[model samples]
Target: MKTVVICAGGPIDELAPLEPYKLSDEVVFIGADKGSVYLLNEGIIPTVAVGDFDSLSSEEFLDLTNRVASVKVASVDKNETDTDLALIHSLDFDPQQVVLVGVTGGRLDHFISVLNSVYRFQKDNPGIQFIVRNKWNEMRLLTPGIIKLTTNPQLPFMSFFAFHENVEEITLTGMKYNVSNETINIGSSRFTSNQLLDEHGSISFSSGICLLIRSSDQ
Candidate 1:
């Protein structure tokens, strides 16, 4: 699948190592601001670099330009955050999936901002899948449909929540806690930390969005 991975400049400890992503097929990397430095440190030259880049030192910035293929600079005072800019640019490839990494941790507001962007993008382009993955969590938005899931041995914990409103006609199978024709209302914690009973499972819903989070114990 065609995928665009946007790396933001969040806390390094919170960000998962990019080595695995570098080996994915048909993947393009976008470095937002200091994210370029982070990618370069891991020996991955980004296809494009987009952001204000005020956080980088002169030497670091120079090294980024010398290494990365393209750099799309934005104003520091621009309305979009670095991650937001990266998201916008990611659509240029019309990728089948947009994966965001290094966007969580450090400042909560920044993480929320990226999530708001993800919501908007998911609404605008329903065909492309949007994902936000950090060291401990992998988050995605589930629209009204039947979604097949596979167990992630590394991320054994899974949680689901109603996105904006109550999700109706929910049916789950192959899960430890299966439900049928149920509703997950806003602020419901009933589905938190559920596990897949088998290698595969399914979640079917008819209305509203669901936030699916697969987490690791770490």
Candidate 2:
């Protein structure tokens, strides 16, 4: 089944777009403390809530315990971050796709860490599709394949970053600005932000991994 695992980090500001995509049976909420309050406020109860309750008040914690189907509480002193643990648990269900929400804002460190974790998961499980969505942008990790992207006119910025050393034979088509037979390496910001010319664009890489960020100013 297609499951969207919502991580309990960052601000839950862009959750409206995600409402229609949520499946009652397949939705999993990883409430990292106060995130439970966000879910409750939205009138959506999580199927499984996992996190340390440090960010929530006693009453909020109690409310989540009562409302959620199952609660997996962790210690404040755990090796993995709450979001990491949540992602691991989500994978246990063997979902077709995992979309992480409320995971891209606030502290810069946390945001980078979450993106790194997504790439790590992609490396580990090549078949699974994972994405991070926010109000302004949608980010996904790509590995050696052609990907078709449909542009939202409101959100015209499309960028690609090579996460590895040898990203070879990268090509783009249908974009206002295209790259051809390019080698995008780590530490290079050459492909930072570009505009989409058409309704759709495509990207292909012969080797290595890249992170694609499709964003908008408005």
Candidate 3:
């Protein structure tokens, strides 16, 4: 499957752990105003650099234009956020999966907006997979089906949260905490946190939507 990486302007420290997985050709750097600096430091030339660039000096903006293949400048007055513009551009590539890096670990509003965008994309295209990755966590949305989780062996905590309605008929296997045919609804906080018992675990639900958050404190 074709994969595309969207690099937004956020805390670079949170993304350091992900360096090993970075591939030059598959990345699309979204400047998000000041994010262009981070991309340049990593030696990544963005396919498309976007945002109103209000945070950048004229020199920096000129540097960004010289480095990237295409620079999409928007007005700071636009309705959609910089990240939103980045996502929209990524979709144009018809990628099988989109992985967002440097998207979290900063302002709560931006993080929440990015989360909402993930759900919005899922609603628009049910089959495509979208994931947000930071130093500590990997978040993905699930519709209705079985989700198998094998312990990373490196990072061992797995958690689930309901994004839409509660997830119904949820079942868990091979975990320290187990749940069977239970409903995980908003305000329930039933499945906020769980641990992996064996090397692997599986989750299945009959209906509803949820976000499977696999994380490690390290």
The most accurate candidate by lDDT is 1
* Model 1: lDDT of residue 33: 91
For residues 58-155, what per-residue lDDT tens digits would candidate 2 score against the true structure?
Answer: 88888888898788898999988778877888777778788887887788898888888898998998888888887888888999989888878766
Best by TM-score: 1
Considering only N, C-alpha and C atoms within 3 Å, which residue pairs clash in candidate 1? none
- Give the distance in Å from residue 204's predicted Cα in candidate 2 to where it truly belongs: 0.7
Model 2 clashing residue pairs (backbone) = none
Worst 10 residues of 1 by lDDT: 13-22
TM values, all candidates = 0.96, 0.91, 0.91
Give the alpha carbon lDDT tens digit for every residue of 166-218 in model 3. Answer: 88999989988898998888867667668888777899998888888878878
Poorest 10 consecutive residues by lDDT, candidate 3: 16-25
Q: Write down the TM-score for model 1.
A: 0.96
lDDT of 3 at 9: 78
lDDT of 1: 0.90
TM-score of 3: 0.91
For residue 58, what is the lDDT in candidate 1?
94
Candidate models: Cα lDDT each = 0.90, 0.79, 0.80
Ranking 1 against 3 by TM-score, winner: 1
